[model samples]
Target: MGRTILLKMLLFFGIVFAFCTCGKRPVADLPTFHVDVKQRDSASCFFSGYSYVMLETNMECLLTDVDKIKVDSEKIAVLDRERILFYEHDTGRFIGKIDRLGKGHNEYLSIDDFIVRDSLVYVLSAMQHAILVYDVYGHPIKEIQLDAFYKHFDFWDEHRVFLSSDFGNDTYYNFVLFDLRTGTVLRRFDEFSQNESVFFNSFSSFSGRNNKELYVIHPFDYTIYTLTDTVFVPYCRFDFNTEETFDMGKSFAELSDQTRNKSVVKYLGNLIESDSVMYLTFDLFDSHGIGTYLYKRCGQQSYLIRINEDFISDFPYLSSPKGIHGNTLISVLSASTILDIEETYGLSFFRKKGLNKEDNHVIFFHKLE
Candidate 1:
């Protein structure tokens, strides 16, 4: 290895050794919330009503789908594949888009995730091992290259951000606290487990955006950890009320294909958190059962919301949401579906000017009472 690479490896091991005391809690020690998946309710049973904002779809700002969404007080950013499309928060007025999908110094091949910290937009291009920073408009500021491979990331603080790969499939560190300005490794979590293999990597491990806290979860592990200044501490656990159990301590690579295909898998996760509740969407690797549950942040009271009953029936892709405006949660649907909804429910809505459902997507903002 090169001298610089060798030095980084040593630094990583040293950091892991130093922070060993921020230990993982025993499974029995974590607090658990019980969810009754069978007792399901339609979206209307929980939400009083919803309002929508149709994204302006002219020739300039056309998007196929919303891969991910980040909503702030005044702006909304949508990752439509490799491009980041921006829109007004109140009205879906088209803002400019950031399309730097080239093999140049300021370009990236793919965008795994993106976040608006303040005035700047930080786009994560995992395959390029770089995060291209830009102003609110699509103008390029600079690129921060990285040594480690991280598919998803969220800010831990101003100076540091948390980067994580798969839960147990990575050959080296699964999680790292990385410095944004200097590109230094502040800390590394659980280094060198099994061989490198990608498994269940599509899930968004980080949530708790409203509170500015980091809450992360994996598909196989039941525990959720809150990131502190030092290490991750157990925050809560999902008690699915099943009597069956498996080895939560081992890496996913240690398990066979049957175990992986048969086990529980969390899709597009995030464990969406508001001030009062944490929303979880999960499945058992089969079509027979897929459920969503809302658990209280301070208490154990929970309710299961049934998908396929309404609103395109997407568990997390309504579509790929992080738009926390208030008590309101957001989802996406085809604009043409509105006609179907009105006809099926025998209800009428005030249709907008350009309400063509041929290829347009509408944003639904709903509040749970």
Candidate 2:
């Protein structure tokens, strides 16, 4: 009887061990879809015959063109509209604008960065050389003076703001963290050097995903940097020296000798998050021309989407291709003339058709496939 009991106990323990060793099955990953929106109008607020708009819930607002006016949602606020506008979801009003107080175009208002809360909007105005806080109704609430031209401002949390500036040279640009509630500078970093002369003509901080990081891009080098409390680190850098399979146009070469070397890193764009993946559009230019490259960041790998020039040349005057709030891709395309390339597949044929308004002017959104 004892021996039989012992054998049964050993068998039960062995079965339990086997079950514990078998771990949970790994979750399957899904394939990412690529979507593009083609704009119908060729001339708008966006510099390259394009416009910037955002879709939220059931409403959309067109920021660039004055003609195609859409209903602005109450949930999103139109913060600023000097050259490039910014919208915040929480405030539901324009946060920053050019101070029209006794100023002309010579003293135009330029907002490089902003942070909005329930009651006030904190703005870093580059041309103004100060931080301006405004109420929801575009009224000035307060101001913080600074010695440098503040280029970009980001929020670390509800109370802290990060600011970046250029000192009229490539190497002197600095980043500072300010306490918004107290109007005090908490930290600053001035050791980093920027290659503004070679690659980036200008730099601005993109909206960060979390409070821990701030992302900035240099257009000329196609490089991106991230700043934290401790240091300014290089995050992702794209070198545009790759062999080109096709050429759209020599847009970069058309700039004057002084501006020819500069490249655009960030225009008005956004980061789209789906499932566990993040999608970002890096608007870049090379000797070939201006184009948008889609990048995907998975758990460990970061790579560019396998899109060809044929896909780009098919739509001339295409501005920033932005991701919608939903799972769609939207962009504004403008041209002196719009063309119909829906039937064309090759790059050479699409360029030959040129711009024909009947085919080109429209805002395009494609469901990611």
Best by lDDT: 1
Q: Give me the overall lDDT of model 2.
A: 0.46
TM-score of 1: 0.79
Regions more than 4 Å wrong, model 1: 1-26, 42-45, 167-171, 199-201, 209-212, 241-263, 272-278, 283-300, 310-327, 350-354
TM-score of each model, in listed order = 0.79, 0.52
Cα displacement (angstroms), candidate 2, residue 92, comes to: 11
Model 2, 1-369: lDDT tens digits are 999999999999999987754432222322333322221211211112223322221112234341111112332333224432334433323333323333443233665555556656566666677777776455667777765666666667777777765433333656777776777777876554432322232234453343356665433333345666655655543333332322323232332243433453333234545566665665545555665655555566554542334445423434444324344455444333223443454333324645343332334444332
The CA lDDT of each predicted structure is 0.66, 0.46
Over the stretch 72-149, how does candidate 1's per-residue lDDT look in tens digits?
A: 877777877688888887888988889889898788888888898787899987788788899877899998988856
RMSD of each: 7.8, 14.5
Q: Which residues of candidate 2, in runs, are more than 4 Å off?
A: 1-108, 167-173, 193-203, 218-223, 236-278, 286-288, 297-319, 322-369
